[model samples]
Target: MAAVDTTLRRTLIEYGQTTLAVVVLLVGWEVLCNVLSVPKWLLPAPSQIAADTWEIRAVLPMHFGATLAAVVGGFVLAIVTGIPIAVLVVYSPFLRRVIFPFLLTLQSVPKVALAPLLLLWIGYGLHSNMIVAATVAFFPIVINTATGLESVDKELLELTRSLDASTARVFWCVRLPWALPYIFSSLKVAITLAVIGAVVAEFVGSDKGLGYLILTSSGAMKTSVMFGVLLLLSLLGIASFYAVAWAERRLCPWYLPTNTDPPAI
Candidate 1:
């Protein structure tokens, strides 16, 4: 009962803080717009954005689906490919020494600048978008997985060795479990990056997706619609983040419990 009460209290406090911050932001935005006489075209009020959301409800879902597909597809690809590569790198010191520098260089390259080239090569649409998204997210997963695998305590390794554990057994029983947290942390970061990548690809070349809507709306000075699309993008990011968080909670229940308290009324 005490633990439950404490958890509830913490959740309520967090909810109140979030609500306060949002209220403050909206109030400031409303005041600033009125005082500065900001043109609707330049900066539509929050209400206008809300109205625009309803106005575009019909088409918004289609665009959202397009972007979501790219993000999820690419993220899955990154995880599948990156994990194996990370395992290889971690298991082989020679491979790690030889490839780590190249991996760093590849990661440092500006993916946005390469978007056009990707479009040119893949010839637009979902393939190009997925490629870009996967590229953007791949490095983090690789780095995280490698870090997790390598992070196995030396003492743990020695103990396993003393027990005459095989390399595969050590990895499955000791290293992989130890690395799960780090892998999930990287995944959270990668998911957001995947969304950004999909949006960038849409901006560069695509008839569909939120990024394309943003481009079209901005060009036509449909500020309200632009705001709507931006809102959708923000929601997408939040949804992806929370999805990962939920998965972490389920898969790693030993790590932490979900805070379930409601805000004080």
Candidate 2:
């Protein structure tokens, strides 16, 4: 109970520090803009951005829903496809040799560069955006999951094998649990990348989404609206990342990240 209390206290302190830092930064920004008489079109104050965002609250729901759907769909697709590919890579040396190079090549190609091609092939719509997002988010999940599965303790493997455990049994009983941390870590990364990919796709070809809103706002020199959209994007990314982290804690209660708590005396 004491350990739990200490961990809770540390977590609260960390959040407090982060909140205080953000508040300080915003305060400084507001003061600087006011004192300098900064042009709103060039660099709007945080207050201006907030007001602009509030003004667009009605339209925001539509754009927000579009982006959210694409993000969630793409993220789910990446997870669905990435994990099976990782399993195949782990279990089949031939497939690993054939697939890894291809995957690396795909990863190396910038998603922004690939967005146009996806737009052309998939047409300018939600499907294309989802594909782009999946492509952007796919590599991390595959790599991290493969690494985790292959990283099981050799001694544990030997013990399991000596017990006449089948491959399926070994994987289910030993490897999967061991790999949960890595899988969840990849998920957190992939979710953010998914958001980026969706926005990039929207930038390339869409008439909708926050990315479209940003592009139009910039062309109109509505810097406040652009900043507001950006702030929304950041919130979306942060929220999704934390959602994954919360799931990780629920699913892998035994897993504790390093340095999250002070050393016990």
Candidate 3:
């Protein structure tokens, strides 16, 4: 009970700090815009951004849903595709030799640069966005999983082999379990990248999503609308990242990066 209390207190403190920081930033932004007498089109104050966001609340659901769907779908696809590829690479030297180089080359190619090409090949729609998001997200998952799988203690592997454990049994019991933390860490990163990629794809060519809203607002000089869309996108990314982190904490309760254990009192 004491440990749980301590963890809860720490969490509350962290959230309080974050909220305080955000309040300070928002206050500064509002004051700066007011002091400068910036034009509404150039730098609408926070109040203006909030009003604009409210004005578009009716249409926001559909665009937000579309973007969310793309990000989730692409992230799921990356996990399904990347893990198997990682396994093959880890197990088969021939595959590792052939596939690793290709993946490296593909990673070097800016996925945003490929956005237009994706639009050309996949057409202008959520499909292209999903592809782009998966492209941006999968590399991290594959590399991290592979590294975790390969980095297992050599002594443990030798012991398992001495016990005449089957390859499948060894992998299922040892390697897969050992690699989970790395996999989840990569998942956290991939979720954020997935959101960015979906937005980039939308930016490249789309009539929906917050990204599209930002582009149209940019042309019309609707700074308030752009700020609203930017905030929405940031919220989406934060939500996605926290979702992954929640799963990570559930699966790896022993892996606390911030030393959640109670300190000496």
Model 1, 1-265: lDDT tens digits are 9988888888788889999999999989988988899999989988878887788889988999999999998889889988998999988999989988988987888999989998998898887898899989999999999999988899988999899999988988889989898889999999999999999999999999999999999998899899889888999989998999889877777666456445446
Model 2 gets an lDDT of: 0.94
What is the lDDT of every predicted structure here? Answer: 0.90, 0.94, 0.92
Best by lDDT: 2
Which digits, one per residue and each the tens of the lDDT, describe model 3 over residues 227-252?
99898889999999999999999888
Question: lDDT at 59 for candidate 2?
Answer: 95
Top TM-score hit: 3
Candidate 2 clashes: the total is: 0
Clashes of each: 0, 0, 0
- Write model 2 residue lDDT over 46-128, tens digit each, in one string: 99999988998999989998999889999999999999999999999999999999999999999899999989988999988
The TM-scores, one per candidate, come to 0.88, 0.90, 0.91
| Error in Å for residue 49 of model 3 | 0.5
Which segments of candidate 1 are over 4 A away from where they belong? 1-17, 257-265
